[model samples]
Each structure stands twice: as C-alpha cells, then as structure tokens.
Target chain A: MKPSTVPASTPSLRQSSGRYLQTKWKGLIIAVPYLWLVLFFLIPFFIVIKISLAESIIASPPFSSLLNWTEDGALQLSLLFDNYAYLWEDELYYKTYLNSIKVAFICTLICLFIGYPMAYGIVRATPTQRNILLILVILPFWTSFLLRVYAWMGILADQGTLNNLLIWFGLIDEPIRMLYTPFAVYLGIIYSYLPFMILPLYANIEKLDMNLLEAAAALGAKPLITFLTVTLPMTLPGIIAGSLLVFIPATGEYVIPDLLGGGNSFMIGKLLYSEFNNNHDWPVAAAVAVALLILLVLPMMLYQNVQARQVGVKT
Target chain B: MIHKRSRWVIAMLCFGLAFLYVPIFLLILYSFNHSKLVPIWGGFSTRWYTVLFESPEVWEAVMLSLRIALINATFATLLGTLAALAMVRFGRFKGRTLFSGMISAPLVMPEVITGLSLLLLFITLADIIGWPGARGFTTITIAHITFSMAYVAVIIQSRLIGMDQSIEEAAQDLGAKPLRVLWDITLPILAPGMLAGWLLAFTLSLDDLVIASFVTGPGSNTLPILIFSRIKLGLKPDINALATLIILTVSIGVLLAAWLMWRQEKQRMQDRKMASRTDH
Candidate 1:
C-alpha cells in the first residue's frame, strides 16, 4: 500500500507548488528590508559624498547643487574640491584628528587593563554570583548616558564631591581644577565605555576550555605561565573585540568631550557639530563626516569580519 | 599562585563595581539637594522635582519623545523581524552580504556621522519628492527607526539562530503551508524576542540626543534635546531631578526583567527534577 501510494501522490506537483510559494514569501521578506536600507541607510551616504564635493552656499539646505542645466540644454556638473582641500590645509583639523586618536588609544588600553581583571573575576565566580555581578555591571549602561556624564561633572567640579572629600582628608589645600580638562575626558570615556570592554571579554573568557589550563599546569607550567601561555592567547579575539568596541566609539565621542573635556579637548565629533551648527558650513561638515567615515572604515570592517567569523563558527 | 590571584581578582572586581555604581548613587543623592548649585548640599528638599514638573516645555518634550518612541518601536520591530527572517531563514540570497553589512554597520556607526548623513538625505528628499514637508516628528521618527531596527535585527537574529527548527519542520511535514507554519508556530516562539527588541528600540529612541538634534526643526524638541540644551550651559538641579527619575524607572525595569528570568530558570529546573523523579 505504501509503495502504491508513493506513485499516486504525484510528488513533483506538491514540491513545485511548495517551492513556488516559498519563493514568493522569500522575495517579499528580503525586499522590504533591503529596499528600506537602500533608500535610507545606504543612499544617504552617497548624498553626503555629493554634498561634500559641492560649494557651501548661503541658502536653504546650505549647499550648492551638484548638477545644473547649461544654456544649450546640457547638464553640467559643478564639483568643488575645496572642502577636502580645506580639511587638509587646516592644521587644526589635522591636530584634532591626531589628538582624538591618541585619546581613544589611551582610553582603550586603560579599559582593557581594568576590564580584563573584572571579566576574569566574573567568569570564575559561582553561577548565582555571576548573574548578579553581571547585572550590576550592566545597570549603569541601562540608565541614561548623558546623566552618567553629568554625575561625573558633579564629582569632578571645583566645589564638587571629590574635591570636598579630598579637603576633608587634608590631602589638598585648595579645590583642584579638574573639570573640563583632558583628564576629565579620559575619565569620562573610561567610565562610560568600560562595560563595552568587559562584556565582550567576559563572553570570551567564559568560553575558555579549562582543560587547556589544566594541561599547561600539568606540564610543569606555573600559574602565571599557564595564564600567559594558555588563557591570554585563547582570549585574544575577545581582547581585540573589546578594544575595537571601546576605541571606535571613543574616537568620535561627542558627549564625553563636550560635557567633560570642555573647550580644552577638540575631537572630530565636536568639530563636525560646530561646523554644521555654529559655522553653518554644510559642505565643510560633510567633508568632516566623510573624513571621519574614511578613518573608521578600516576598524569597522575589522569588527564586522570578527563578528561574521564568530557567527559562522557558531552555525 | 591560584589562591593569591583569586584575592587580586576579587579586589579588582570590587573596585570596578564601585567605579561603575558610585556616580549613580551620588547623582541620585544630589537630586534632593535644595540649593540651585549642584555640588552644594543644602537641606534635602523636593524643590527640583517640583520645578521639573512645572516646566511646560519639559512636558511637551517628554510627550513628543514618548510618541516617537512608540511609533519607532512598532515599525522597527516589524522591519527588523522581516530582516532577521530574511537573514536566517532565507539563506544565501542575492545581496546578502550588503544586507548584513547595512544591518550591523549602524550598531557601531558614530552618531554625528549618522545624524549628518540622514539630515542631508531628508533635505534632498524634501527637495525631490516634497512628501515629508518638514523635518520634525516624521523625520526624527524615521531616523530613529533606521538605526533602532538595526539593533532589533541583531536581537531577533540571535534568537532565530538559537531556536529549535525541528518543531517547525515537523509542522511543515504535517501539511502546513509556509505562511501558516510561520503564523501558528514560528511567531509565537519569536514573541519574547520581538518584545525585547521593541523595548530596546523604544529606549534607544527615547535616549537619542545627537541624531534627533540633527534632524529636529523648530517646535519639535525631544526630551534628550531639551535636557542637552538646558545642561549645556551648566548642570541644572531640575535636570538632576529628571536624571534621578530616569534612573529609577530604568532600574525598576531592569530588576523586574532579571527577576523574571531568574524565576523562569528555577521553574525549568524544578520541572526537570519532577520529570526525572517520575521516570525513576
């Protein structure tokens, strides 16, 4: 009966219809998101590139159109290279870019040193303690970022909590001027982005094979040697992931530099904001955005590659 | 060596936790200070809270933010779910790499760049299409949706990847249509993830200051924009009050989520135990 049923059922007819329905459903599902991204996310970048090449005009929208009609009914393209040239010629922009990179690099290093120990501790903790500890780590992240920066302002102000505490301890004769310095900027960045470093490292460290460390120890390796030779190399991906997570965002950080670093610190984010808002130079702002994107493209691609590879390994 | 390293790890952990939390506690404490100056400790009072409540602009901004967040969450979740399905279920479609790149790029993109590029896009669109008349509620909501959906897609994609597919395959084997199987079996399983994605999208939209700042026109200030503009001059007691309130709300929400997850884990354990006992 089963053998007779197979031929009677017409398997090709069922399969073809099912496949046809699936193709339609698949197309619809893919098209909606793909088109939305193209229209909003992808195409806007091209517009930025176009505007960066156009002259800044004193009009609504604030940039000259890229294309114009000539007298003889010919389309003319008017592109200005001055914006990029201006960014090149201005030493301020160059210095600001360098300074931002330096700040981000230093902060990333600090975060790694601080966050690694914490992540290792969490991984070694009991299950119940691990959950609670992780929640504590992530709690600040759930709150408002701006408010956290504001909290630091109160702490680091001239007459603020930290200064008052120090004076009570007789550690200082006068209230130290700490707010709005590069010091404040570094502290603010490290405080806010510490979680980004810790979470990735924790995930990576948690997945480490304990047997490898055991084997290293059995081979007459000391605890420190086992850690250095086995644990550290195993968590290299995590270290890279965490560093990139902190460094990439820190390079273009606007809020921390603006609120904490004040006028003393000049990051690319602040430069772009001022160029667009205060100076109203749309073309220059677009140029700054383009330059920032170019600088970030390498790291961004690295991060994406790491993430894709991780997902691939998992699947 | 292990024993010594454990002590150091504990100390580091304590220090890191304190660093993360002390500022928040201090900020909460200062909200009650009566003095206008933020650092000074006057007698504790609710004056700042009263001031925050009295400001009409603050009310307007809060209302506008809630509206955008609500609209943005719904649309972002819808689009994000579709994208996740396309990514995980569809498998190896045309332009798949570009699609995935767009989905993940926004997670790490700088706010200033995103804001500037999106505002330019809007201006160009207004000139060419003239549909979105002005850059206000609609524009800000769209901008929020674009980035927020990226986050939602990541959340749902992970959930989709971890899901057991045998149940879905079994449903299809029992003469269920593809869409029928999706509606009846797949979506119910994905409901929790979708809810999480929605809440995250809402929070992101509500918290955004930079992107909203770029796209906002006259008479369309969001809560973050209002808070930012006010605090840019100096720290305000009323904003401290606002911050305390935000922190309280977020804490309660996070704690509730954590508790729920804990309870769910315990229940799973007990069920497993019961099943084992019965089998014995």
Candidate 2:
C-alpha cells in the first residue's frame, strides 16, 4: 500500500508544484512593477485632479480636502472650479500656452533640419567612423543637461565669448545683447535638445535599406526626388519620434525659459513653477498641470503608439 | 557608397557637432579664468576649483546626490528589469496594453507634472499611512526611481527583444528549472544592458533639478538644486569648476563604456568565426 501510494502521489505532486511555482513567479514579476507604477505614477494623477478641484488654504498640506463629513453624518463633496475658471478667464495663461506651443514647434523644426543631416552623415560613414561619430553625438548628452544649458549662458551673454569675438573682429562696436533674451532661450533649447532629435533619426536612418535608394536612382528618379519619395516616407516614424521627444519636453521646459528667457519668454513650465513656488498656490499649479496634460495627451499618445509599433515590428 | 550629396551632409555634420561641442569647450576653457566675472578673461588660475573643493554645502549636496543616485539606480534597475521581463517574456498578460502605456508614459511626461503628481502621492500616502512622514531623501529617491525605472525598462526591454531565446530554451531542454535557466543564461547575457540602464538611471537621478526641487523638503538640496540656486543668482567661477569636473567625469565614463562595447563586439565576431571554422 505504501509503495503504490508513493508512486501515484509523486508524479502528481511534482507536476502540481511545478505549475504552481511557474504561476507564482510570473505573478510576482508582473505584480511588483505594476503595483509600484499604479501606486506612484498613476494614482497621483487622480490626486492632482482632486487637489485641482479643492480650494487652496493656508495649511500644512496647503489645499482643502475634497471630501468632508457633514454635521448630519452625510458625505459631502466640495470641489471649487475657481482654479480652472481663473486659468480660463486670464489672458496670460492662454497666451503662455500658445507661446509655449509656438516655441516648441519652431525649435522642433530647427532641430529636425540640423539633426537629419547629421544622422544621414553618421549612417553613411564607415562602420568604425560611425561608431565614433555616434559616441561623439552621445557624449555631450551624458554630461549634465543643466550644465550644457548653462554652457550656453557663457557663450551667449552680453560680454560672452560670441560677443567678445564679434567685437574683436570689428564686426560690432558693442557687445550684442544675446543672453537673457528670447534668442538665448531658442539657442539653449536647440543646443540642449538637438541630441534627442539626432538619436532617433540616426536609429531610423541607419535601418534604411540602401537597395531601395539604388533602385529609385536606377529608375531615373533624381536624387532629391528619390529622397523625398523613398527616404522621407520611410523615416517618418523617426521624424515623429524625434519631433515628439523634443517638442513635448520643450513645451514644458522650465530651465531654459527661467535661465535664458528672463522676463520676456513666458513658457507654461515657468508659469507653473512660479505658481507653486512663488505664490504657493497648489490648486492653481495642479490646474495648470492638468491643462498641460490635456494639451499633451495627443502627442504623448502618438509617441506611445509609435513605440509600440516599433516593438511590434521587432517581435 | 558615396553620393554627390555627401559633401553637404558632411558639412552639416561638422556644423552640428561644432554647435554641440563649442559651448562646452568654451565653458571648460573659462573655468580656470582668474576673474570673478564669467565672460571676462583674466589670467588663468585654479582658484575656482579650490573654492569648490572647500565649500561644505557643495560637498553635502554632492554626497546627497551620489547617495540618491546610487539607491535610485539599484532599485530602478531591479524594477525595470522585472518590468521588461514581464512585458517581453510573459506573453500577453492581463492589462498588457495599460502596463506598456504606463511604462512608456513617463519617458515623455513633463517633469513638472511628474514631480507634482508624485509629491501629491507622497503627501496622500503620508496622510493615509503615516509613512514617509517628511519629504526629503526618501521622497526624492522614490520620485527618481519612478521615472528612472521607465528609462531602464526601455533599455532592458530592447535588450530582451534582441536576445537569443534558444539558449534559454536549451537550458530548459537540458532539465534546468526556469529560474535556474534565467539566472545562469539570461541574466549573464543581460548584464551589459542592465549596467547601461543602471548608469542611465543614476545619471538621470543625479541630474534632476526640477523634480527634486518639488519633492525635496527643507535641508535636502541635491547637487543640481544647489548648483541651480547659485547659478540663478549669477554664474560663479566655482560652479564653472564644478561643471568642468562633471563634464570630465561623464566623458571618461562614456569613453570607457564605448571601449568595452567595442571589445565585446570584437570578441563576439571572433567567436562566430571560430564556430563556423569548427563547423567546416
């Protein structure tokens, strides 16, 4: 009886245990990151929404709670729309939003013009040269981004290197006022974010099949026409990816505007920071964030969709 | 392979690279200037470096940033690796779309939004759970990990996709358990990608100013925050010295990484040649 029971139970026990362990391992893998993100990344948006609806108060937390228990034991919800209403009524907010979009768009276009050719050059280089070039492209990126932006301040200042060189060349009698101006802000954004544009474009352009171009050329299509028809269409995803990478963050760029734009350039990011830090208006800041998120959701979704497609293609 | 347009492309490349590097080289050049004024060139001196070294606040900020970066990198790499595995290896799990979206969203999310939301979460958690009672190191680290891990996940996920699955399958076919196969074959192969992800996370955490500013409490200034506040008033020579040091360290690290990757690729090519030779 003992021998018979052992023989039957052993196989079943092992099989069951193996299946159980597999499921448990898989569950743990999914659960840990999932729960962490849901807790920290996702739930906080809801909180922002809640706080955006609540009134700003002079308290430790600094915002009134959305929920309150009434004296009659009824659950009462209080959500003030004043923060949003205030944003809508104010001309400054809409103008800032539009200005931010315009800056981001123009910067993205400039980055594309600069980055595309660089990416093309890298892709056309010999393998050894390509590696070095790619590394060079990424090297500045590894350095502190803020420091890179700060580096521009040294170059673009009134008495900075560029101005000094110009004056010495007798090109100008006085130092050009480049820093703390809209020009400085544009220069900084392009300088800092050009790498972002180049990388994706490089990745896309590198994958381009040379045979297609050859075929197009062989068919009597001129080089420029072939490029427009074959190359550009194929690398549109990269263009979109790089453009979004630059545009989304550039729109909300706080550092560049604060440091270089001075009092002239008003980006949504700086406005949000001043609201939260300078005015201590949590509700207003949250409202600003929500509005910014609403504006950005489309591009963000487009980016995610492109990434997913790329992954899908790979798999 | 050369085209008539190659000349134009090459010129563009030169111009673009110059644009990127010229400002940085100028900053490095000016860091040694004796003048207190940033733009003026007094005779060269290393006084700024000495001043930077002597500043206790700078030291403290550096130490804190390093600590936060270290912790953030480790935890981020772990969680990110797990997320990558779950996404790439675990086939079509529940809420996979949502999971993928959450993983990628942080990559492009505005820092202000991410920072504000995370701070709000920490506050709510503190109110409800009474943990993380004050926002400082822990809150900053948590915020860094949340975003940095998204980056790590992208890196590791690409690694996972590019990896050869047959090796792991072979290990399983040879009677190795799944966990054992992962530990022995998968993780070793993935070490380089993991290292890259870790470094990226570390750099991101160290470089963050905006998010850290939002989450950081009193007496918790990271290096970027301190540097930012100083630079906000005006450019200081000491800060330039600090920037120069950061640039130097990053260049060295990047060069080392590139060299190692090159060597590894060479080794892989030689191994493949040998394998084909043996097969012949």
Q: Using alpha carbons, what is the TM-score of model 1?
A: 0.95
Error of 2 at B10 (Å): 0.6
Docking class of 1: medium
> Model 2: how far is B46 from its true place, Å?
0.9
Q: Any runs in candidate 1 off by more than 4 Å, and if so which?
A: A1-21, A71-73, B276-280
Candidate 2 lDDT over residue span A1-315, tens digit each = 023444553344333322322555989989999999998898998999999999999997899988899999999999899999999999999899999999999999999999999999999999999999999999988899889888888888887888999999999998889888988888999999999999999988987999999999899998899989999998998999999999999999999999888878899999999998899899999999999999999999989888766654444
User: TM-score for model 2?
Assistant: 0.95
Whole-model lDDT, candidate 2?
Answer: 0.90
Off by over 4 Å in 2: A1-22, B1-3
Q: What C-alpha lDDT do the candidate models reach, one value each?
A: 0.89, 0.90
Q: Per-residue error at A51 for model 1, in Å?
A: 0.2
